[model samples]
Target: METLANLESFVRSAETGSFSAAGRRLALTPAAVSRNVAMLERNLGVRLFQRSTRKLTLTEAGERFLASIGGNLDALQAAIAAMSNDHGEPAGVLKVSLAPSFGVAYVMPLLPDFLQRYPAIRPEWHFENRAIDLIAEGFDAAIGGGFELAPGLVSRPLAPAHIVAVASPAYLRERTLPADPAMLNVMDGIVMRSGRTGRTRHWTMRDAAGNEVATTMRERIVVSDPAAMREAALLGLGVALLAVPDVLPWIERGELVRVLPRWYADAGAISLYYPTRTLMPGKTRAFIDHVVEAFRRDGLAQRLAGSLGL
Candidate 1:
């Protein structure tokens, strides 16, 4: 049988599309990954990848090889891990990706309790706005919304990704508040440019009564991050469309005020996403269970919807 290390290097390099990226995930040098892959290719007697300075493309043989091996790799890893140590207690780096503002505001607080329960599992959390390739990047799980579900991954609903118009109390001192979404066209708007698309996102506002209105406004300042947009709105610059979870604290503190109370944009449901595996790592399973239970207990869906009469 070929070395497990060689098989791992082959699989990681294939998933990430570059040896350098695969090396980062595997904790090896790019040269090391390349050498292992080369050894694997030699042993298998097939050209696995077409390498270029700019990109790496899987060869026909490589595609076929990956298709055959990809499904079983998780099982193999689990078997090896179980053989190496105690199988009852999960112990490993639990890598997770999260949307920064929402994760910090909500999920990060739950870490203390989670860690206390699963002390053997160490978390390696990344906070960012970009959609990550969970399997390719070696992430155990991710929390966010709007990511296209790739093959071999699954998502569980967490809460509605709701955005509402908000501004600082000081900013709206003399300005008249709009009664309807269409009236927002004349207001100074603080908006976010999509990180993936690089375009300013428009809003589709809905009321508690189920009335829908799509509106676009003149942007006073455009930011790439949600936190920055909240800051801009706090500075009394303009009205900003933002995730309710991101600005909930500010609103509660009376530093910011809701522009249209009943109106919100339905951005889709935020979810916890992970790879579908027969034998999931214990750390990952524990995290999912704990978080889902916590959300359920706290009524996160309704809270995120500002149902406490916020």
Candidate 2:
């Protein structure tokens, strides 16, 4: 019988593509991950991975091993969950990944209450703009905005995210407000890029006639961080296209003014996603339930609607 610890290290290292990354998730050192995998390889008497300077590729033997053991591993996890379910207490470390701005503005504030409720569960949070591979990255859950989701993940809607075009009061005072999407081409605009893809996202909007249009404005500044973009817009650097929830406080305080009111971009729904598995850990399940209930009770949608003057 394979030891659970060795099996876990093997599975995580295989999925993450690097021992260093797997180690980070497992709270082990790279050398420890390597040793664990080496032990597994010795017991099985075959090479699992083909290691090279640039990448780690699974060998035929490794692929077969993973296919054979994947279900057993899942069953083991489910069995553990079943055993722990009797306790009826959320106790464990919950690792979550989230979009930087939304995590800071909305989720972080709510976490204090959650932590207080579940004192036994320690939460580890990571905020980034890039899409995370939940299973491979060993994240228990992820909170994100936008529609595109990878396969084999279950997503639950958290809240509706509304976005609008905004500029500093100074910028609006000097330049004529763009009446339509076509006029935005002549103005300096800020664009956001994906850290992994290195491609700038085009702003999606609708005209007065309800025609869907995609516009990529000339970029005076390209920022990877959404918070930095908001700051730049506040400094009158350029027109900023931002999520309404993210910029609402600033707009309410008159630091920024909503531009192109007639043409508003559709704000994508914010969702919490996790790997599709038959059994979810108690802590993860509890956290998701808490988030849903909190958002419902807080009237987040109503608050957002009021902010947008809708």
Candidate 3:
């Protein structure tokens, strides 16, 4: 049988489209991954990949080989891990992806307890704002929403991704509060620009009475990140549309006030995502259970609903 390392290197490199990214997932050096792939190719008497300075592409033989072996690799690894009793202690690197603002505010606190429970598991987390391909990127799990639910993946709802209009108390002190969502157009607006599209987003606000109004604001400040938008609002620059979970603390502390108390935008649900495998790693399973339980216990889902009363 070929070495497990060689097979793992080849599989991860193919999935991530580069040896460097595969190395990050496997905890191996890029040179080490390349060497393993080379040894595998030498033994099989076929070139597995077409290598160029700019990119790596699989050969026809490589594509066929990957198709035959890709799905089986996880099962095989799980079996080996089970046999070696790695599952007993739930040990290994646990890689996860998360949105920066949300992860830092809510999830990071759970790390202390998580580590205490599973001392053998090491966490390697990436804080990013874009959707991620969990399987291709070799992430054990991810937290956020708007991810494509591709095959072999599962998403569990954590909280409602509801957006509510907010502004600093100082900014609202002198100005008249809008009687309806349409009036927001005349106010200074701090808007978010889509990182992927570079266009400002507009949302239709819905009231508890089943009334919907499309609100367009005069853009006084524009930012690419949600956190930056929040800061701009806090600076009394303009009104900002933000997720309730992000500004809940500020609202409670009298730092920020809701612009339209009865209206909110339904942006979908924040979810925890993971690979849908029967033989999932113990560390991943543990983390998922921990997060779900915590959210439920804290009533985070109910608390995060921006339109709770309406």
Candidate 4:
């Protein structure tokens, strides 16, 4: 019979794509991890990985086995660890995906504290903007907005995802402030091209009186990333629609000011998404709680949801 240690070694190697990395997570030498995997392969009479000096690629059988057992493996281990209070600490590699800008600005700040509390957890964070197939890609969790709910995942709302028009003070100087979003048509407009849609983004802003105003600014500049759009506006280029989380620091420092102050687009909630709540590993659960508490401490929901004074 195959030992649980061999199964763990195999799964970690498949997920990390390297024996060295799996060994580091499991606190074993790379040679030892390799031997465990080799033993498992011999017992099963199948090759799980294609080995090369550069990288390890999963064979079809390896992929199938990983898919079958990966989701349940952590929960099972965590349960056993919990049976004895002295060994209740969750210890494993936690792979997560996040948007680069948001992750750096907000989520990264909270990580130090999370690490201090959950010293046994090892986090592998990937910063990206594209939508990821969590299970197919072997990610433990992801943070973003507008993710379509997949078959076995769950999402917990962290903060509001609101977007508003903003520009640098220098750019707005001597220029007539728009009375409404419609007046932006005549202004120099810095806009973003959507990565997902591959088209220029358009905004429909809502105001306090429950009135909506769709912007029709001429695209003086079309940028690809949210950071670039913010930078363009800062260079006195034009007004751009931007997310609060991306531009909040700049706005706080008075580097940027909101246009049409009362109007914002409610993009939805920026949520922490992961595998099913019931099966969530302790590391991921700890991260979710830490993030939510941080947001609550800062009253981030109010700030992002159009509650700020101009």
Which prediction has the highest TM-score against the true structure? 3
Per-residue lDDT for 206-229 in model 4, tens only?
A: 887778888899999987888899
lDDT of 1 by residue, 79-156 (tens): 866564454676678899998887887899999999899899989999987768787677889999988899989999
lDDT of 2 by residue, 1-310 (tens): 6787788888887888889888876767889998999999999999999998778778999999888887787689788887787667888889999988778888888888998998999998998767666765678889987635788788898776766778898988878877676678877888788787899877678754767667667899999877888999999999878887778889889998877765667666788898776777889888889888887898776555423443
Better of 2 and 3 by lDDT: 3
Q: What are the Cα lDDT values of the candidates?
A: 0.87, 0.80, 0.89, 0.83
RMSD of each: 3.8, 4.2, 3.0, 5.2
Residue pairs clashing, model 4? none
Stretches off by above 4 angstroms in model 2 are 10-27, 37-70, 146-148, 169-179, 183-202, 207-209, 213-225, 236-238, 302-310
Residue 113 Cα positional deviation in candidate 3, in Å, after optimal superposition: 0.6
Clashing pairs in 3: none
Ranking by TM-score: 3, 1, 4, 2
RMSD of model 2 against the true structure: 4.2
Better-scoring candidate (lDDT), 1 or 4? 1
Give me the candidate number with maximum lDDT.
3
Q: Give candidate 4's whole-model lDDT.
A: 0.83
TM-score of 4: 0.77
Candidate 3 lDDT: 0.89
